[model samples]
Target: MPGGRLTHRDRRDIGAGLAEGLGYAEIARRIGRPTSTISREVARNGGPGGYRADHAHLATRRRARRREAIPHRDPATPPDAYGRDPDAVRDFAEQLAALMVRTGVPRMAARVLARLITDDSGSLTAADLVQRLRVSPASVSLAVRYLEGLEVIRRVREPGHRRRRYVIDDDVWLRAWMTSAQQHAMWAETAQRGVDVLDPATPAGARLAHMSQFFATLSDDMSGGSGTVEDALTVLAALRHAGTSLPVAQVATALGWPPDRVTEALSRAGPDRLTPAQLGALQGRA
Candidate 1:
């Protein structure tokens, strides 16, 4: 009965409340839900910066369907309303899985990602994912490996577990963003080399030079707030390690670099591409 979750129809009113800049308590009173609930929904989804009931509702629905079809005995929520309905979560997961498949993600990888993204717990061991996904051990291993390389998911350690958990944190997008920009930067450098090789004054050289300039500039813009994309990359990275103090070594290792180099780079790189594995290796040397 947490008031935090809104119904579909209630989303419209939430929009009204938001437009008027009403406080959480006022919004909760208007919606007949708990203030904490509304507060959490906004905080978890996007803070005060960008929130839309419609989008949140849709995301909730998609999450629910991925878990299972809504059962007949489920309580009637206001059109977009959601309660602690187990079936709704299942339904959302089920639907999301289907959508991802249509978009060309392999079925197993899509299911694993869907579950990781939607779960309120926000962390799950590979065994948990495998059990929930109902895929083979090898499939889970492969999917998790691919996701880790893409920097779109992470491994979280839990006490009493022999194996680490796999999770999609709020920062998954940050890792992805930095990874991409670094990739583009590398491309730009390569293109510059192409220009030098082909003759700087020739048509081919000019084209390559432009390619290099375009990517290098694009990479720069990606880091700034006013840049084309809000560097969700840094914000997302910040969201992880929310409560705990991240060890300097841990941060460096997760980014793959020696401590001094990491220290230098954090000042300079500011969320650009860096390898996590190499950093971890360097930490062992420390």
Candidate 2:
């Protein structure tokens, strides 16, 4: 089995196999390589139907030359690498961005998020993003704003600096999830209101009522307010009411929840350390 990089001859064979209508696994087996290796090579180049061995080989050589030509100018830090493969991180970033796009994330925002997460510095100015992504500054600014609106990224001011940089942290996903649940609740409320205005016995009113129920159910599921989640929240509320940190055993005892349930509830509720008022706000009561 060939464990090293695919040779030009291998690519030609792959192209031939594709022309012969062979699946990726068949081609890989014939070439003595893993299916995934063959799959990535094919997908990265031009995909199954469009793949051309000569064109792929040339493109590969061009990318190799570009990497070699770019000098590593950061003396204080070594080149980014994953197990000595400097390009692995870049490849992963693009792959992640592509996956995000496929899963309904806006393309520009996905690209920007991927770049930010892969950056060694963990933050980037709009100008820095423009340069790195080779996109217009306006495009970067718009993508950044979209991410900020979703609560998936933050803008932080650098010390003694006038400009801000964008960053992502663990809290980002939590906030985004909460924001989505909040929106669901808002939709539920709007739909419920529509039912009343449209006459509850009519077809339109029935549709609106069903819509309201659907969103309400989704909101409850997302916010950990139903099923086992309801019990967990009750435990959380009790703990918060104590006004001081309590032991896991004590919390479990007070709420009649299992220790494991208490632990999970606290993990979801804490970290951000939501006060009673904040919790109320999440539920749209405040």
Candidate 3:
């Protein structure tokens, strides 16, 4: 429907919709804008409870002016090899950084990650980051350290270069996901300990127990072995097709997998973790 930056009237409408407790989708529908537009607008200004039309309009104008003042590229920088527009690329990076900020990443760290990931090499030295982000070297160093702590980026030195580079690997997200799962598991363990220390029958203990269970389940789901869900599902399907319990060796042979690999897959789809139907299918085997 409508396109371009939101007008002051649109911000007023968004404020009215928030006041009425309308959802983002409903507000966007009423204004002929995308739901994401409404969501980001509200999120950028304040949350639903604090959003003010005038404040939001002013903030948007300030952001626009700041963006306008930023240089898109350096004169010494080469053109994109694929001929993509530098301005568009810069805008997309900013959008990505904003989205990451909304998802709980610190603003500087998010900007660093966005810039690194958007680059063709997925790597940048502190100097490169400082120059490109127009931030101090100390700022880039802090951001990279934060990102590294999350396991989403790592430091490496080029073969002949003395300078260190912060590199985002292709599997950066996978590493970050696993890091999160590990954190959840740690929380689950701590919560369980709290439950024991407080006596499980007490109200506080019960709350801790629920918290422990929630995080434990989340950790299990997110921390599955190196195999993907598709691989696990395939193993389950093979068991289902067998119509009777098959030993690991037999299933491995049937699936053309090595014995150890099949064993790993079967362990991942353990009976205690399977659905009723899946459990029934593999009843005789562990």
Candidate 4:
């Protein structure tokens, strides 16, 4: 009953309902309509306090007339029915680039990525990017190089053509994620070297140790997926099983790994790797 357009009488009723201090849900129930319908009607017109029945009805009629005046396209029609809509593509590209920039992507890089991504062929040459983006060739070169370094895009050589086409593969995200993890691992190793060079008893060494621990955890979480944590815990669990005080070097030799690898596993294992029961068992045996 409430699906059709609201009548002047319904609008009057809605105004009256709002005047009666009724919430949108209660007003909707009284009018036999949905709460969202009541909410949208009030919001678009003016709001609860400012929504006048006559004004809202007149505004709704004007909107309806405006919408009716616009021509609707049939889905069966070709995309370029009246010729290519350059404005539509430009608006779409602008919005996509803005969205990328909001997600921490650099502005020019976002524009370049947006153009390449929205291309019909899903690939583009450096010249094509420069033309579409309206930027200099040098600018395109910088953006493409940055995107390539981040693994967000890759270059492909055509069979006959000489200019390499830049493309975003489906596995771009996976490759970028792995690259970030690899970088974190490299940083963590560097921090650990800092820890070794500085005396652990000093404040600077403690800070470096903490930094190393944080990066090691982050690296494992990114690259190790769930398996890395499980493997580290397994190593801790084995050590817990040994029930003997062993040097980290001795543990490394027994595990047939470099001392640093064993140390990394121990660092990643964290203090809470084992349950209280396991810890108590290890403690009692010790």
Candidate 5:
């Protein structure tokens, strides 16, 4: 049989001859392979002068494995070699943002989440977000505020700095549960009011009552009580302190309200909510 296939060792021996300036025909003859087979192998991997049998063989195997892992491709064949291109990272970020948008996450919120996921530190100062995302400071501000409301990320501040940062935590989903509980409470309250207004003993009232009961149970399961409340308060308080870093106009725009309303909400939430007015006020003390 014509030596149609070569093992890694065989390829290595053949490559060694070429490295020593032997002709392909001579090397192939020594390795008991066809001259054309040897020539094609070296050329396909790297030129003959740069070929390494082990490197080429591994590359071939890796491509085959990657292809096989794709499921649509043949198990025995390799795919293309992987590269450490920075463009790949950028593509990943864009793909992630697109995926999030598809999942009913608002565009701006999706952008912020995508950035947080891609960030090395799992957080970014507003300025960093503005710069990296190539959007205005207002966009980052608004996006971050919405994310906060959704209970996905918390805000943080650097020591002695006027700028605020946003962060996603290990317990993000746990806090999300509390957020769910709060929402459920609102819905339960609304449904309870409807039952009271329409007659609690009626079939319609009974259905709404059942709705209230369902949501209330889910809310209780999610809330896990005062401990979680305290934890959320701590994060929001830290964020309120950081909010001082935001400009008044930016804060107003982010909250989608007048500055006065912003001030009122901040004051009402009292050092507990991470509102801009509180941050601004806290900064004055420093």
Candidate 6:
């Protein structure tokens, strides 16, 4: 297999293959390269319809030269104030960014998110990001905007500060999770609306109804409300295991919860809310 950088001839062949309407895998097989290589080359230069061999080859050389001109950091350097090896931190950040890219994040946005997540303060101004990532201000701005839209990070201004900082906090994941659940709820609502508009017996309406139910269930699960049901079940399980009704205080002690929480769970686990098996497990607990 070809392992080194692609040559001009290789690019010409790629262009010819694209023009011939060949897929990336077949083109890669013919060129003795990986499909990923062929796909990335075409994507970075121009899409299949717009790709030109000469332009792509020249662009590759320019990019290579630019990368070569950047100064290399020595891994043997002393650690930072927090005793972190700078080179190691950079490699980890890049690895995290790559993983995010694989999970459908845009490349630049993933790089920005990874950098923010690894920072000691979990906050950075635009200038800090631009300097650390060695990218332009515009790139940083665009990446932050994308992340902000997803609720993964947020912007805040310190008192008396002119510039706003992008911050990732302990609750960042919670906020992102809620944002996703909210989106799912919107999808569920929209799907239900479609069901209402179409005949319920129609294939498309049935499909929409199923979609609505799926998204609604997923949203409810992801919204963190399912814990209530779990708590109720736990209360019932405690009573069932004892084979007798237990006071809220005793159940709380067994479950390591406050008595009032146990009482609330017990109150929610009434016959209306439980199945026959769950009601049997309840055993008349009050």
Candidate whose lDDT is highest: 6
Worst 10 residues of 1 by lDDT: 225-234
- How high is each candidate's TM-score? 0.47, 0.59, 0.60, 0.48, 0.44, 0.60
User: Where does candidate 2 stray beyond 4 Å?
Assistant: 1-84, 230-286
Between candidates 2 and 4, name the one with more favorable lDDT.
2
**Whole-model lDDT, model 2:** 0.80
Tens digits of per-residue lDDT for model 4, 148-267: 878798899988978799998767778888888888888889988998999767899899989888888788788874436665776686688898757889887777767777676777
- For model 2, residues 1-286, the per-residue Cα lDDT tens digits are 4678889999999999999999999999999999878877875565665678999899788767765776755534445454434455656666667677667777679888998888777788988887676567888989998998887899999899999999988576787888999999999999999999998899999999999999998998888764445665787678679988799999888877678878877666663777887778878952
lDDT pick, better of 2 and 3: 3
Better of 4 and 6 by lDDT: 6
Which of 1 and 6 is ahead in TM-score?
A: 6
Cα RMSD of all models vs. native, in order, equals 15.2, 10.9, 8.7, 13.0, 21.9, 10.2
After superposition, the stretches of candidate 3 with alpha carbons farther than 4 Å from their true spots are: 1-79, 225-286
Task: Give the alpha carbon lDDT tens digit for every residue of 183-210 in model 6.
Answer: 9999999999999999669999999999
User: For model 1, how does the per-residue alpha-carbon lDDT over 1-286 read when each residue is reduced to its tens digit?
Assistant: 4524567877677767878999989998988887766765664343444567788788668767755753443465333344565645655675576566667766567677878888877778888887666557999988878777777788877787677988788877787788788888898999999998998799999999999999988777665522233433443364365655465687656656465644543455343355788677767796
Residue pairs clashing in model 6 are none
Each candidate's number of clashing pairs is: 34, 0, 0, 0, 6, 0
Which whole-number lDDT from 0 to 100 does residue 155 have in model 4? 93
Q: Rank the models by TM-score, top first.
A: 3, 6, 2, 4, 1, 5
Give the Cα error of residue 209 in candidate 5, in Å.
1.9
lDDT of each: 0.69, 0.80, 0.83, 0.78, 0.72, 0.84
Candidate 1 TM-score, true structure as reference = 0.47
Q: Is candidate 4 or candidate 5 better by lDDT?
A: 4
Order the candidates by lDDT, highest first.
6, 3, 2, 4, 5, 1
lDDT of 1 at 214: 93
Alpha carbon deviation, residue 32, candidate 2 (Å): 10
Question: For candidate 4, which ten residues in a row score worst on lDDT?
Answer: 73-82
